[model samples]
Target: MKFDVLRAHQGDKWYGVGDTRDAREVEVQHLVDRGVLRKAAPDVLNKAAPPVQNKAVSAPKNKASK
Candidate 1:
């Protein structure tokens, strides 16, 4: 799971404040329980947004015959 470091901590790995990193739940469950780390917000850059069509489809115009 990914977590946001709320405070500087050290374990099997070192985590600094404001750092976003991924770790196995089993490995960091203690820190998470202690509020040292919280779930990180999803990264927008990594998410793929659906393609959008901005142009509106228009019907063909007909000319009147005299």
Candidate 2:
């Protein structure tokens, strides 16, 4: 899992922007429990921030003309 450093901290290395850590869930939770890290806010998880092609189909526009 990923975590954002809420405060400065060190383990095997420093943790912060431009050099984020990829750690196990438990490892991240440990820091959060100790007030060292925080859950990252929700953001883009795709090639771009997306509505992702708007796949929901709409009813035919001319339904009453059938």
Candidate 3:
């Protein structure tokens, strides 16, 4: 479980108790109680960032009428 949480942290993802390998509420609670995993800040997970606009070339438009 520790490994799983660490993996999720490294992957920049949130690890919820319901999404753990055991998938038991108690297990997740235990981790939180033991300080193995803590609730991540909202900004850390849902920060307002600029959208990634595509700057690639566009496809040519068809001239024929369908």
Clashes of each: 0, 0, 0
Tens digits of lDDT, candidate 2, 1-66:
666776777777876543455678785787779877766655564136546687787777797855
| Residue pairs with backbone overlap in model 1 | none
Regions of model 1 farther than 4 Å from truth: 45-66
lDDT of 1 by residue, 1-66 (tens): 788999998866787898886989888888889999988777875468889977996655755532
lDDT of 1: 0.82
Better model by TM-score: candidate 2 vs candidate 3: 2
Model 2: colliding residue pairs:
none
lDDT of 3 by residue, 1-66 (tens): 222342343223565443433335554666567655555444465467889999997766765632
The local distance difference test score of each candidate is: 0.82, 0.67, 0.49
TM-score, every prediction: 0.58, 0.49, 0.29
- Among these predicted structures, which one has the highest TM-score? 1
**Given candidate 2, what's the lDDT at residue 43?**
58
- Summing lDDT over every window of 10 consecutive residues in candidate 3, give the lowest-scoring window: 1-10
